[model samples]
Target: MIARIWHGRTRVDDFERYSDFLIERAIPDYKNTEGFIKLVFLRKKTEKEAHFTLITFWKDIDAIKKFAGEDYEKAKYYEEDRKFLLEFEENVEHYDVFAEEYA
Candidate 1:
């Protein structure tokens, strides 16, 4: 399995809106992607901002390419993101999943 991780942050005031966008829009798009396996969405809030992390599992590199294009390490974004995100992060991280368990 291949794991792709993306992280972003929004000001505390925009947190809820951004979160809603992720759930209502981003997640569904991921579900429709070919070879997409699972998603782990995480959030952390501070007095100033909220951090969001999206970890997506894929069957292989090609699977990620279907979503990320030829530059698989680069981050993907929607036009909606600019309204909430603090800055544009240019890249994402990927890892080779050697082990996992679901219960």
Candidate 2:
């Protein structure tokens, strides 16, 4: 499995709204892609901004390329994201999952 990690930040006031958008839109959008395994969405609010990290699991690099296009390292953004994010990061990091388990 491959784990793709992306990070973003928005104003503190937009935290809940951003989270809602992910639940309502982004999650569903990713689910439709082939080889989608699951998503681990994370967030934190500081004095100035709300940070979000999206870790999406896929079957392999090909599966990621399907969603991310041939340049899989580039970060993917949605239209609605413009309303929330402070800046767009250039790339995402992918890791080969060696081991994972849930208790």
Candidate 3:
């Protein structure tokens, strides 16, 4: 499995609205994609901005390319994201998932 990590930030006031967008739009889009495993959304708010980290799991690099195109390292952004994001990052980090278990 591969874990793709992406980071973004929004104005503090837009935090909840952005989170809702992720839940309503992003999560569903990811779920519908082939080889999608799961995702975790992490957020931290400061006085000026709210930082968000999206960690998504996929079956392999081929599966990721299905969603991310041939340049899999580049970040994927939706049209609606422009409204909330402070800046558009060009790339995301990927890691090998060696172990996971449920208690």
Candidate 4:
């Protein structure tokens, strides 16, 4: 498995709206894309910003490419993101999944 990780932030006050945006819009888009295994959105609230990390799991690099296109390393954005995100990240980090355990 491959993990595609992206970090982003929103103003503390807009946190809930941003989370809703992710669920209503982003998640659907991800589901429509090829090779999407799962998505987890983590949020941490601070005085200045609400930090968010989107961890997406894919079957493999090829599956990521299907969603991310030829330049899968490049962070892709949608029109809705501009409303919530303070800055658009240039790149996303990827890691190979070694192992996992669940109850």
Candidate 5:
């Protein structure tokens, strides 16, 4: 398995709206792609910013390529993100999953 991670931030006040966009738009888009195993979104809020990290599991690199294309390390963005993001991250990180445990 492969695990892909992406991070972004929004103004603290816009946090809930950004979260809703991910649930209503981003998650569903991921579900429609081949080899998409699972995804988890984590959030942290402070007085100034709301940070988000998206962790996605896939069958392999090919699976990620289906979503990210030839430059698979590049981060993917939705049109709506431009309005909320404090800055755009150009790339994402990926790792080979060595083991797993479920609670």
Candidate 6:
């Protein structure tokens, strides 16, 4: 398995709006993509900004490539994101899922 991690930030006041954007827009797009097993969105708020991290699980690199296209490493962004995010991150991180646990 593989995990794709993306990080973004927005003004503290826009946290709810940003979360809505993720749930309403991003999640649906991800769900329709090939090889997307699941996605977990994490958030942290500070006085200045709210940070978000999307941990997306895929079956393998091929699955990710299918979802993200040939240049999969190039981070993709949605137009709706511009409304809430303070800055567009230049890169996203990916990790190998070496272990797991379910409850």
Residues 1-64, candidate 2, lDDT per residue (tens digit)?
A: 9999999999999999999999999998789999999999999999989999999999999999
Could you give candidate 5's per-residue lDDT for residues 1-103 as a string of tens digits?
A: 9999999999999999999999999999899999999999999999889999999999999999999898999999989999999999999999999999999
> Which residue window of length 10 is worst by lDDT in model 2?
24-33
Per-model TM-score versus the true fold: 0.96, 0.97, 0.96, 0.95, 0.98, 0.93
Q: Give the TM-score of candidate 1.
A: 0.96
Worst 10 residues of 6 by lDDT: 66-75
Across residues 54-81, which tens digit of lDDT does each residue of candidate 1 receive? Answer: 9999999999999989999999999999
lDDT of each: 0.94, 0.96, 0.96, 0.91, 0.96, 0.89
Better of 4 and 5 by TM-score: 5
Residue 34 deviation, candidate 3, in Å? 0.9
lDDT of 6 by residue, 1-103 (tens): 8999999999999999899889998898889888889999999999899999999999888888877777777677988888888888877889999999999
Among residues 3 or more apart in sequence or in different chains, the pairs in candidate 3 whose N, CA or C atoms overlap within 3 Å are: none
Q: Positional deviation of 60 in candidate 5, in angstroms?
A: 0.6
lDDT of 4 by residue, 6-60 (tens): 9999999999999998899889988997889998989999989999999999999
Query: Counting only residues 3 or more apart in sequence or on different chains, how many pairs clash (N, Cα, C under 3 Å) in candidate 4?
Result: 0
Compared with the true structure, model 3 gives a TM-score of 0.96
Clashes of each: 0, 0, 0, 0, 0, 0
Q: Show where candidate 5 strays beyond 4 Å.
A: none
lDDT of 4: 0.91
Query: Which portions of model 4 show Cα errors greater than 4 Å?
Result: none
